[model samples]
Target: MLIIEGLTRRYGDRIAVDDVCLEVPRGSFVGVIGRSGAGKSTLLRMVNRLADPSAGRILWEGRDVTALQGRALRDWRARCAMVFQQFNLSGRLDVLTNVLVGRLNAVPAHRSLLRLWSAEDRAIALSALERFDIGELAAQRAEHLSGGQQQRVAIARALVQEPDIILADEPIASLDPRNTRVVMDALARINREFGITVLCNLHALDIARAYCDRLVGLSAGRLVFDGPPEALDAAAARELYGLEADEAVDHAPALPGPTPQVAPFALHA
Candidate 1:
């Protein structure tokens, strides 16, 4: 379980997070949505310790994560995984090698940087690929794979790390419709099968309603709304989206892709 209390972050005189408090239980999926610069990514980064909160405490399981250092910090980090919007893979390396690098946190730094993975590491990497159903692309270089394939490889890498929760920062923002569904489906399956908690920042309400169990909305660095997707009606959407809603939806095409597996949902665990 993850517990955040009075979470806050500020840049000089500007406040990015304003005493927001939340709890994520084990094996739950939550989505965050808002216009640009909503501090959604900032909130996730704080949980992973990528960005420190100026004032607050993040409790993982039962320990105060903010107080951890050295080995403790490293171990805490290993349990939280991050997936980037730009698929941050080493394009020069083969897909298999890229996923194998996920084990780096547990390996010696020198060995990890040199890419001298052990035989056991190789097995772990292969197993992750199989889990994602992308083992066939093992030998292919990262740049050679399609966007969907690259994202899948990234997921496999995260899986190999044995993370408890996945923090995706606008993961599908750059993908085409087809690839978008592929990547989103992969995330959904991981959440269902492996019970990996998911905290995703998304731009589309439709996607949030489809895949996420809960929705947290931010506007101008403040928490404006938090509830189930179905509860966020057109009126509430207008408040969050502002006067641009009509123009935005008018331009949105029905993106072609596999319809996501909607299920009985609950607040973030």
Candidate 2:
């Protein structure tokens, strides 16, 4: 379980996130919805320790996450992987090398700097790529792949980390409708198949409502609503997005509910 207590982030006199508290049960798929600058990114960053909270306590499975330092902090980060909106792949690197970067936590600094990846690690990276249907592109440069393909590579990289929790900060914000479905489906499949807890920040109401088991709404910096997707009625959406009744929700047809069936990749001994 993940426990967040009195989480807050301040910039000079302005508060970005205000004393928000939440407890996330393990293996739950949660989507964070809010307008621009509503602190969705900040909240996820604090959980990942990419950003420090001015005041708060973050606990994971009874351990004080906020107090970890040096190697311990690095270990925590490795366990709590993050997927960013912009696919942060090295354009010059091949897809396999990019995915192999996830194993840096276990690689010695000298070996990592020399790009001396072990055969077992290479097998694991290829397995991840195959899981995402991008195994054929393993040797291709990351810059040559389309946005959707790159994002898949990013997900593959995160998977190789073997994280317990995935904090996705608007992962599909830049993709088109088709790729959006593909990416969201992959995330859902990860949660369903591996039981990894997902905390995704999303802007599209339709996507969030369709894929997430629970919806968390924030406005201005405070959490305004937290419940199942059906419980988030028009009124709550309006207040969350500060939109007119008709404009509050995205009325687009919902994405297909079934998780995508990509073949699982098994590691070679």
State the C-alpha lDDT per candidate: 0.81, 0.88
Write candidate 2's Cα lDDT for 126-202 as tens digits: 98888888999999999999999999999999888888899999998899888888788778878887888999998
Q: Which pairs clash inside model 2? A: none
Instruction: Indicate which candidate wins on lDDT.
Output: 2
- Residue by residue across 1-269, what tens digits does model 1's lDDT show? 88989989999998887888888889888988887787888888888898999998999888999998888888777788888888899999999999987888878989987888999888778877766677888999999998888888988787777888899889988888777777787788778877999889988888777778899888776788889878988887777779754532322333334534433222122
Per-residue error (Å), model 1, residue 124: 2.0
* CA lDDT, candidate 2, residue 156: 91
Q: Candidate 2: which stretches are off by over 4 Å?
A: 244-248, 251-263, 266-269
Query: Positional deviation of 99 in candidate 2, in angstroms?
Result: 0.7
Candidate 1 weakest ten by summed lDDT: 260-269
Steric clash pairs (candidate 1): 24-269, 25-269
What's the CA error at residue 10 for candidate 2, in Å? 0.4
